[model samples]
Target: MKLYPIESGNFKLDGGAMFGVVPKSLWHRTNPADANNMIDIAARCLLIEDGNRLILIDTGMGDKQSDKFLGYYYLWGNDTIDKSLKKYGFHRDDITDVFMTHLHFDHCGGSVQWNKDRTGYEPAFKNALFWSNKDHWLWATQPNNREKASFLKENILPMEESGQLNFVSLPETEILKNSELGFDIFFANGHTDKQMIPIITYKDMKICFMADLLPTAGHLPLPYVMGYDTRPLLTLDEKEAFLNLAANDNFYLFLEHDAHNEIITVQHTEKGVRLKDVYSCSDLF
Candidate 1:
């Protein structure tokens, strides 16, 4: 199996929002903010090639939103999904499966795009079977007031409309062992309801697609949780358990939202689990 880190684009978000209640004095040391106090963010996606299947995890925020809407996030950078795919000699049509960790716009907006002639929306990956768990699908579609802004209809409904939407059946034990997608599924709820984190096995190494569960290395501390999370206290519990397991197993974390640091590993420290090393996909593969 081969894995590629597909960088869709970069954007800026309020550092306060990204770090939640964590003081700026702490998080700013790692993710330094701009004059406007917006921190650099990456819409980093992952592409996996296992035999006949070409699976993409998370589509990143697409370029369909109006300028006014995008201005809020301060989108930047020239990296795009198509360009990144071309770098690996692949195309969007080559993707057979799209496993969405969640339906937030930054994660799934590129799943759908404006059709030619700009009449209506359509699935961006026409050949891919977009995957989202049943419960998270409902939660995103019928979003609560707090999360409604992040779950945009244009970025989501088109997958179901194209008859390409599917769901991974959660196992009774919660941990899905040897999933057909060639990974173990870890269900995390603190960030959002039933968010699926794929723990992939490649070349004798366990690599985890750390979605919002661990956005950046700055969030390594136990108390650092995103304000956007529905349940912050629950996030603390989830992070503590996951970090312990990650530190113990020596797993490589594939960060999705960290702009500068591509991949990281954690180690048990006197304070808590802390960043051990940082590397990129090319360095490992």
Candidate 2:
């Protein structure tokens, strides 16, 4: 199996929002904010090429949202799914499975795009089966007021409408082994309802797709949960358990929202699990 770090795009978000109640004085040290208090964020999706299947983890924020809507996030960068795919000599059409960690616009927005006629929306990957768990699919589609803004209809409904949407069966335990996508899934709920974190084994190394469960290296601290998370207290528990497991097992965390730090490993520190080493995608993949 071959893996590629797809640079979908980059944007800036309020540092305060990214690092919940954590004081700016603390988080700013690792994720320094600009004059506007906005920090750089990346939509770093992952692509896995295994035998006949080409699976994409997340699609990032697509270019279909209106300028006014996109402006709120302060989207920046030239990276697009097309350009990034081309870098690996592939295209969206080559993707057989688009497994989304969640339905947030920034994560799954690129899965759907405006049709050629501009009349309506359509699945971006014509030949791909968009993947989401039943719980997350229901949560996103019938979003609560707290997360309604993040779950846009245009970015979601088209996949189901196109008849290419599929649901991964939720495991009774925390981790689902040997999923249809050929990886283990770690179910996390603190960030959102049933956000699936993919645990992939490649080249004798366990590479975990750390979605919003651990957005950046700065978020390694258990209490440093995102303000956007609906259940911050629950997030603390999930992070503590997951971080300890990652540290003990020496898992390579593939951070999807960390613009600067691509991959990292954590070790048990006196202060609890902390960043051990940073690695470029080139170093591992």
Candidate 3:
């Protein structure tokens, strides 16, 4: 399978929020912040081509929200979902699957957009099957107060309404069986309950979509869990296990939220697991 780096857009997030409990002196070294303490973040995704399927994993935040709503996040950058797709000689409709890591706005917002008339919402990838696990689907649809703001109904419901919404069954007997998608699905609850990280195998290399599990290279350490994670302790456990596995196995981490680093490897340091090397996708392939 061929993988294309599809950059949708960039936005600024509060550095403190991104790196919970971690001091600014520590995180700012890698992800420097502005006067307002906001750091640049990328909604970087991938386009996967295998056989007859063209899967676009996690479209970035779309342009459907109100200006004021977007202003809060301080969205920036020239890279757009359509333009990046065009770079690979593809379009929105060409995607056969919209594999969402989770239904958070930045990850799944671009899956829906305003129809021409400005009257209603519609699926951005009309021909694609919108993919998410059933439990997370319910969590997002009927969001709790802590996550209600991140799970926008407009960005999510349109897929189910379009009759294209489908679930990757997670039976207790076969929980880690890769979710019927070709890639291995790493179920992480630290970010959200049942969030799936697609561990994709390509060209004799293991490329993993480090959804919110490892938002940026700065977040490589096992303890650098996000303040936004509801289950921070669980995140600590998950990161330690995942990072150790990545380091030992020499896996390429496909960072989804880091604006600068595309892929990185980890080294076991005295302090903890740290970034060993940074490279772009082209460098690897």
Which candidate leads the pack in TM-score? 2
**Ten residues in sequence with the least summed lDDT for candidate 3:** 171-180
After superposing candidate 1, which stretches have Cα over 4 Å from the reference? Answer: none
Tens digits of per-residue lDDT, candidate 1, 29-87, equal 99999999999999899999999999999999899999999999898889999999999
Cα deviation of 108, candidate 3, in Å: 0.4
Model 1 root mean square deviation, Cα atoms: 0.9
Residue pairs in clash, model 1:
none
**lDDT value, candidate 3, whole model:** 0.90
User: For model 3, what is the alpha-carbon lDDT of residue 89?
Assistant: 94
Candidate 2 C-alpha error for residue 241, in Å: 0.6
TM-score of each: 0.98, 0.99, 0.97
For model 2, how does the per-residue alpha-carbon lDDT over 206-241 read when each residue is reduced to its tens digit?
Answer: 999999999999999888999999999999999999
Predicted structure with the largest lDDT when compared to the true one:
2
